[model samples]
Target: MSPSTPQRPRTSRRTLLTALAATPLLSALGTGTARATAAGDVYASNTDLYTRLPDGEGTDYARRYRRHEMADASTEARFPFHRTTVLAPHGGGIEAGTSELCLAIAGYHPATLERAQADGPVHDYWMFEGIRNADNRELHVTSRHCDDRVALALAAGSLNVLSLHGCTAAQAGAPASRPEAVVVGGRNTDFRRHLHEELRAAGFRTVDGAEVPDLGGDDPDNICNRTLLGKGGQLELTTELRQGMFGSFTRQGRAKSTNDTFRRFTAACRAAITRLEAGPDQAVL
Candidate 1:
């Protein structure tokens, strides 16, 4: 039998209500009262940006997600429900290669939007992308402040979350001589270790996020850590690393062209998730 409509068995009514109530207040404050990051972001939260921007999806911005259904009684004996989720809050032009990486890490092909492997595991995913002509950086909503209802609900319902982000080599404190690197952060120590090991094994440079004070994703409120286990992992890829993953680093190019580096990185991430899922920490969501 085919899978039924996606179920959100873990998103409680209280959680939805709390998210709905908090979003509008932030949006209503407008840009004036919104806290500006060191990068000079104007919006307080995703709700603030969504309220101010034109309602033009597929043009200015887009939101996409997928939550696979649980197996029925007949299939449950053979298949297990995926408890992990991958996220890209600053995808498309905002962070370049993150959107593509998010899809690939969640078991989909970035170019074709199909399952990367026929019998491979497919985890849940959610991405908010900026498809604008220019100035997409203004759309960024930091992870701690990301209040998109769907993103929140999806995260709340999952046991693990793997959030993807892009950062400058300078921000990551990578040596100028060799700048291609990824910083692994978030509150989940086991998840972070797995990611670091897998990425290093795949020939990618990995850094401890604690070395960069600002990028340390240890905040309990950060979206990636707001999972069923109340902890998750975050990967911050440097610009050099992200750019090398695509042949032409434009919005259109990212969707159609991904090189070997991209494949290797995604494969490493999936391997880490698989390790986490099979480990003893696989909490019931």
Candidate 2:
């Protein structure tokens, strides 16, 4: 709980995707001392969350359109177009099944060419998770609440990345947007010296966010570090045993850590699921 805690300011994208569509992603990866207070979290506020970011291949077709609203006791009813979008990455390669206009709410999921390797000379540090909502499942950002939001997508040069974007802090989550740290220098200095030697082989004696200005640093392996990292939920993610070979991945306290800031976000979740598998076949207006 250092790095000058108490964050949540530079936020938008509809309040960090509506707090990552109403938080979940494994309780924002929180644990152990609340995961070091979510690695020094932060995120102000504004609320944009984006709505239109289209490209090519159109097939728009879906209808069930309806409208109605009424609130009392004070008033808080506003639903013209709920606007939804889970995780949308792209770079070609995503058309398993889609196309029927689904940005009006949100729909798309295609990312399975994953990779993970590390035994003795480990250094790839992989953690890709780009899941989204299929056509706004009853809004409020559902998917059983975004599987508790967990992000980590990095793989530049050939492209296809994801990372640290679970969003929260509307009330009590943390890191509202992303980027509080992750600024290693020199043309990718070997992917930031292999992420600081994979956290010094995972012990975390002390890494310091670029010398510690506010507590947060370089996390981009590529893909222009996408936005909407969790709000004030802080940070989390860990797995250590090796003592008894519980899950063994190269013992020595097998560590991989984060608090906030680590983006690439799988090219916007494969360009919003290849634009909904290509577009045109949806009907629910």
Candidate 3:
């Protein structure tokens, strides 16, 4: 994977938010109990998953009425958004840490589009963006299947995308005791490696995406790289790392300042971006 050039100039954070506010949001609903659960993992089985919405109407209601998706969509079309776009597709009870990580990178701003679900039935949900993860629990669309609103953000002029995710250590053959390691992937090797180094400096263990068969991020067709720049990064953090970052072993706490480890991790992300910005022109792959 190589670094790709931005299709447009770097815009201010305010400008980016304005654009993101204009992007359209598609509608959906439903709830399915998760069969899997790990410490710090987010699954819809808990009652708290749907508690945030007005009247407890589930994730769809919040996305439709509370999130102001229509305004986000329309404004997003007006200008090139952030040069670096962060995403957390499995948040709000699917995968913890991811939404928080995206939010951290974006400085608590609405520069990210995180999936909010109390119940969205899905199969192989991680493989695609637009595919519904709720209702009937039948379809599993990959990036090859179709682009969702999140996927369409690439076309809105974001130069890069960084998708955050959480995974079980056992899934990667890692020991339960030390699950603080991370796996970095995506098409932008330079940026990916930079992130890897930064995380290492922050005292967390790391593995290149290529070294992990199950969590490799190099696949071009992977949802991570389906951005406007055609190159992006994906980070798969172990539950241990995520737990420390979120200051909770479950999806119950807020991302407060007390999460020192999480702050360090996000600092590394910002440092990586600064270093990359100083480098030579990236080729738009």
Candidate 4:
């Protein structure tokens, strides 16, 4: 995808306590039972997956997160609270490239594992990565069914949640000639528009997720929309799009060998988040 000029178009809060209260701590619920499946996922939820998988820094699967905080008293006094949280519910082998993208979008260099800029803004991030040699897809828990306690808590505390996901070109209804595309969705219409504008301006093809109901992150119960503002934004990147962003598609390769495409995509996402932050606080209607 090459950069092109696109026509520009003009583009949540509240019930924080209610969302926090309504979200159950799935980790605390030790029921090993599986729920009825609409997605045919192997596990019922992140909590259920935890029961069957090994979780550690270097295990079959891992959960990682970083919540930015004030550097000092003066910084705390001057800086507004970070209101966005980036999420990758199906990262690593499950949805290759998302883990790295999550890190990059959260203001970190995937290769160096450092802040992208010396004084750049870093938003909160949460990732569930599958590191198994095979069958990693079994770790997947659909967005609507994602009940990871940490993921939920981070999202519920923030005014915005930007989730990264992966899908096939066919799933996105993109033609083979232009398979490298993204579907932007979610309940946060303003944030969604910002993403579309910035991504299109950056030359990436974007499809309206509304055209694909399953890919649309509009469900209020969807984890992405379970934020303080009760809405969030989601990006469903095509496999071709994600593969082109890295020199190699393996887990290690993705982190260590991201290309210009990767950087551009992350930059566009960060830009959209910046636009969202600059806007007035949303009311919890």
Judged by lDDT, which candidate is best? 1
- The true-versus-predicted C-alpha distance at residue 162 of model 1, in Å, is 0.4
Q: Considering every candidate listed, which one attains the maximal TM-score?
A: 1
- lDDT, candidate 4, 220-284, per-residue tens: 98889999889999999988898899897877677998999999999999999999988877432
lDDT of 4 at 119: 89
Residue 186, candidate 2: how far off, in angstroms?
21
Give the TM-score ranking, best first. Answer: 1, 4, 3, 2
Q: Candidate 4: where are CA atoms >4 Å away?
A: 1-38, 54-57, 71-79, 282-285
Off-target runs (Cα >4 Å) in candidate 2 are 1-125, 128-154, 171-273, 276-285
Candidate 4 yields a Cα-based lDDT of 0.79
Residue-level lDDT tens digits of model 1 in 1-285: 223333332335666466445532211101111111323454667766666564657777899999888855784455466789999988877777889999999999988889989999899999998777776765667788888999999999988999988877777888999889998998999999999999999999998978876777888888999998999999988888887888887777776889999999999999999999887878553
Superposed by TM-score, candidate 4 places the C-alpha of residue 281 at a distance from the truth, in angstroms, of 1.8
Q: What is the number of residue pairs that collide in model 4?
A: 2
Candidate order (lDDT):
1, 4, 3, 2
> Which pairs clash in the backbone of model 1?
none
In angstroms, give how far residue 180 of model 2 lies from its true place. 22
Cα deviation in Å at residue 181, candidate 1? 0.5
Candidate 3 achieves a global lDDT of 0.50
lDDT of 2 by residue, 114-222 (tens): 2221221111112211122121211121111112122222122112112222111221222435212222221222333443444334432223334432223233321
Task: Determine which window of 10 residues in candidate 3 has minimal summed lDDT.
Answer: 121-130
